[model samples]
Target: SFMVRPFSLGLRLFVAMTAGHILLKVLAGFVVNAGSAGLGVGLLVGIPSFGLMVGISALELLVAGIQAYVFALLTSLYLNDAVNLH
Candidate 1:
């Protein structure tokens, strides 16, 4: 039972990450191409494009970090639950 929660969390994290990575890759390709545009063009396209890239990056970091922490904590909790070492 102790192992159940942690294992479930791990699987959830893996699935979430896979989806995030795929979406990030597709958006990154767009950002890179849009990013290469010149100053005038950049101002028109690059600024917003880069801004979105930054936003997404921050969000991804925050989300992934939270998920990782949750996983670790769940693992620790499960370990403690199993050991029964008050």
Candidate 2:
């Protein structure tokens, strides 16, 4: 039970963080590539991509804080379980 909990928790958090970063990179790439195209195309694509990137960046920051809190809470829960067992 102990091993399962930590392993699963870590894996889940890793996946979430990786996915978020990858999505951010992809969105940023779209904006950069669009800028290379032309003024009109760049205006159409770059604006939306930039806005989405900003929103996602904010979301990622919030998620990072929430993840830290969750990790700390779970650690405390595990410690409490261990102490109560003895």
Candidate 3:
């Protein structure tokens, strides 16, 4: 139970950090692919995709901060447990 807690937290943080990056890359690919298709199609598809990427980028920034805070909080909690252990 004790070990699982930290492991799960780390796993969750890892997945959260990576998933955003992966989605951003996919969106960027869509923009690039659409641009090569044609000007009209490019404007239609690339604009929204690029906009989405921008929004995702901002969200990713926030997630990063939250992740850092969670990590520090967990680490402190773990240390406190270690110190108080019987």
lDDT of each model, Cα atoms only?
A: 0.76, 0.91, 0.92
Task: Output the TM-score of candidate 2.
Answer: 0.90
- Model number with the top lDDT: 3
Candidate 3 local lDDT, residue 28? 96
* TM-score on alpha carbons, each prediction: 0.63, 0.90, 0.90
lDDT tens string, model 3, 1-86?
Answer: 67787888889898998899999999999999998999999999999999999999999999999999999999898878877985
Off by over 4 Å in 3: none
The true-versus-predicted C-alpha distance at residue 8 of model 1, in Å, is 0.9
Query: How much is the lDDT of residue 6 in candidate 2?
Result: 81
Candidate 3, poorest ten consecutive residues by summed lDDT: 1-10
Candidate closer to the true structure by lDDT (higher is better), 2 or 3: 3
Per-prediction count of colliding residue pairs? 0, 0, 0
What lDDT score goes with residue 75 in model 1? 80
Q: Give the TM-score of candidate 1.
A: 0.63
Ranking by lDDT: 3, 2, 1
